[model samples]
Target: MGRTSKIVTGGLLVCALVAISIPVGKEVVPGLFPQDQSSTVTTPAAQLPPAALSQVASVSELSPDAPLPDAAALSDQLKEALKYDGAGTVSVYVSDVLTGEELFSADGWTARTPASNQKLLTAGAALATLGPQTRFTTRAVTGSQPNQIVLQAGGDVMLGRDDSKPNEIMGHAGIATLAKKTAESLAGAPGPYTLAIDDTMFTGSTLNPYWPTEDVAAGEIAPIYPMALFGARYVAGELTGPRPHDAPVEVAEAFAVALERAGVETIGIITRSKTPEGATELGSVQSATVDEQTQYMMQWSDNYVAEVLGRMVARKLGEPVTNEGAVYAVRKSVRNLGLPMDTIWTVDNSGLSVSNRVSPAQLVQYLNILLKNPASSAGQELKGLPIAGLTGSLSDRYIEPPSWEAAGVVRAKTGTLNLVTALSGYVVNSDGRLLSFAMIGNGLTDGPAPLRTVFDNAATVLAKS
Candidate 1:
């Protein structure tokens, strides 16, 4: 058989084997080992919290038609693989998607800093609240003055500066196109007109106080604005750098330049104002669908995109478009999912804020919901996840043992910071049964390298189980 065939055949064989022997209530799954012998393994050091144990118990009574690997053996392996005697605490949660049973858990309810793993929640929240087909629009409307024009930001944070290059999202809808359309609409009635920018879609501070001072200065994050060119940076043509503090004003200036080149003249200083209610729209550019943008955010762990989507969610939910508003919106979205909101405490949509906290169990539960209905909006967001050793953030991972076996089998989200490391996603086990799992580490004095190894090895075990 070819490599693909072999893999498929092996997967089917394991599924068939497991499907044939159902275990009695609370009894060990039959056929894991000989009927007469038993195996022992280490238990996780951290005790499962009451909340997590309750969730586990909810699935304990499930009686699958097929047998599964010995829960004790899996638990032992996970315990051994996840044990890290470093400064930080570690949490692990794993569940069998087919049987709805908790296979292993340790401190699963303990909240920890998630790093980029927070994007998973943000992505889900956006899909749940904004719908899959939602798109942002940037518009040019008539200003209060006859010769003046208002460039209204419609939450297209990634809008391109010009029309030279095309992009799937913002770049496709170029500023130059809008400028040409605006000039045409004026019909030579304008020359050296003053321009203004409307950025009131978001109502609060651009910079989050919780964000580190150095990150803003170093360009790790730009001022979150609704209408900006190239994600708020000067990426016209080939140039890209940190965006100015007054990004919206700068974008208005650039739009003025584009208007002039398109036969419209602009004069005087550009200013900020709210677009009049009855203003006429000269031109508009739209972004890609929310689903595609979410995929991009998840694949690259883009902070700017995440923040933009968060604000979008806030707007959809009738909340202010600020850091606090984003948190409230996400909370509303999660609450609407019928999941408890106590597990999540977020200061900002992008996990860049160290103040964010989320539990391992919460992450796994969210994944389980998505897995239960892969066709649902929540499930569609999973398309953005990086595949182990194949694409996205995981492209460089799983190339070596003991993670090699999971190279193509594991699809997950990775999170890392100074001392935090997290991994959450799905794995098709050796039995071809899908599983949802999450692991997180905090206060890791040893850094993330060793914890990453532990997490990868744990994933490999699940894939090969």
Candidate 2:
């Protein structure tokens, strides 16, 4: 997955309003069943409340006692909320972070498509295996031909072309700076040179086969490459468009363009090859720290950063640096952390693939493990989740009625596919006790917007419990 920016729309509120007055139409429903399944059965649509409400949902109004509401009580409220959606199967799991006592569970152990929630696993694995301070290096070395330079790929996917302006996500390693240094090394020597790209750091397919082919054009993913600039490609300051087939070539071209702009003559076509033996080091740039990169991945659901981190973990484990290798390494790392392995399977780190399966228990338990040791590198992953109504994907969410109480109080990683919606994170209950939860909605026929309210309202219920 290449780093691609997404457009958040206001359609969610519109759908919520429509759902409140009239039942969701069959035509508007997304198929809930997995694509591999045979049929798509339409389920009765759930009714949502009107978007306009007199009173704003507020957490300041509700408070609970020391012994929090028991499991039976919590289950009743959550079930009632989920039943209102009437779109798909709902999985819920919640527990006390301090006592480790289960507060509620509804099909929590069943495997379901996780969407972006899978990034939680990837983030944990990267931090646990590679540590927080790990940095990727991109270097320019002497090429085989005189005046020819080789750009070595060292897993810096967010490499930028401009140094004056920092990238929106990856703020380090500017290609302009590298070009300046490279030009300094060749100060008295050459007139024009050809640039060669060395992208062998990653050893497999540039694109994951399991991903939907159409997602590329849809701007949901880009070619996975070890070396890319500005998230592979950005147009008119917007991160959109299909990934170029030869991403490394495009990177090399950008490097060449940078070199030329820096008063260096770049002649001949850009080629892909390894740096020659004993080649002198010209210049280098290091990527943003792994932790920073992970935070960006979670913040924007940037698939590219997530995939890159997965490969970094794979490299740390001495496994292949391919997509399959990343998946295997991430799962292994999760298991090594003593988290549940069964009922959890993933083919890609970004959760762009529908084949990815995870259980609510796995997600909730993973977070709890990290929350218990917040001082450790792996534990830092919890800080990456989007805060309700504040940052990242949740910037515009949690502002609606009913679920509004969770605003500024709940922090969670969200997941959404056509017919799936998932929320997993920690919330401070009315008792002031921190709790962890994982909720997933699959087979959702009416789409995620209406169901999103259900999930948000459920979390609000927990916050007030």
Q: What is the lDDT of residue 365 in candidate 1?
A: 84
Off by over 4 Å in 1: 1-67, 164-167, 236-241
Candidate 2 per-residue lDDT, tens place, 193-219, comes to 888888888888878999888776687
**The candidate that achieves the highest lDDT relative to the unseen native structure:** 2
What clash count does candidate 1 reach? Answer: 2
Worst 10-residue lDDT window for candidate 2 reads: 27-36
Q: RMSD per prediction, one decimal?
A: 9.8, 11.5
TM-score of each: 0.82, 0.84
Task: Name the lDDT value of residue 392 in candidate 1.
Answer: 66
Q: Write the per-residue lDDT of candidate 1 for residues 1-465, one digit (tens) a residue.
A: 246534433443342233222222211111121111231131111111122222221123333443576799999898888777778889999988766688888998789898889888889889889988787888899988777789998877667677623446547567887888888888857366888888889878888998888777777678888877666667742222566677777678778889989888788888887898799999887877787778777876778778989999999988988889987898789777756777578888878888899888888888877766655676667667776665567766776656755665567888877788999997655453567899999888889889998999999888667
